[model samples]
Target: MQLGAEDTKAIITRMKRAHGHLGSVIRMLEEGAECEDALTQLAAVNKAISRSGYALVATGLQHCMAEGGPDSVDAKKLEKLFLSLA
Candidate 1:
């Protein structure tokens, strides 16, 4: 199922933030920033990306349920997708 506008926008915004974080990480590495600081920023980037992925999967699951409840094949697939991220 296609994502609703709000979900799409939210996921895109999160991804954009993650993208910026990743760029910062690269710049930090180039500048030989402290290892701990770079690692902390990298962790933030990872968390942001993970949150965006979860949001996307949640939206898919929500749409699948609305269309036909959780017993549907699509819902099962979405469940698997959600679990894979764990």
Candidate 2:
């Protein structure tokens, strides 16, 4: 899907932040952090990544649907695309 340059940059920023969070979780683990604390970080990182991916899928689907026209081929293609994301 084609995204505006600014929108693409924003998405990239979100992904980079998520990547950083995962790295932090790894560093914390290496330092032998508490199990509960590590687990919480793990959950947060997972949620962040998942949310980012979902946002991309939603935006792409919206764009596709808009371009494809109501109940058109593009919409069906977008439905499949969204399902794959799920």
Which candidate's lDDT is highest? Answer: 1
Model 2 misplaced regions, further than 4 Å: 72-86
C-alpha RMSD of each candidate structure in angstroms:
1.8, 2.3
The whole-model C-alpha lDDT of candidate 1 against the native structure comes to 0.85
What's the lDDT for residue 10 in model 2?
A: 64
For model 1, residues 1-86, the per-residue Cα lDDT tens digits are 67778769989998998999899999999999999999999999999999989988877777777887767546467668888888
lDDT of 2 by residue, 1-86 (tens): 68676656767788899899899989999999998999999999888877787788777666656877656446566678667656
Clashing pairs in 1: none
User: Best by TM-score, which number?
Assistant: 1
Q: Worst 10-residue stretch by lDDT in candidate 2? A: 69-78
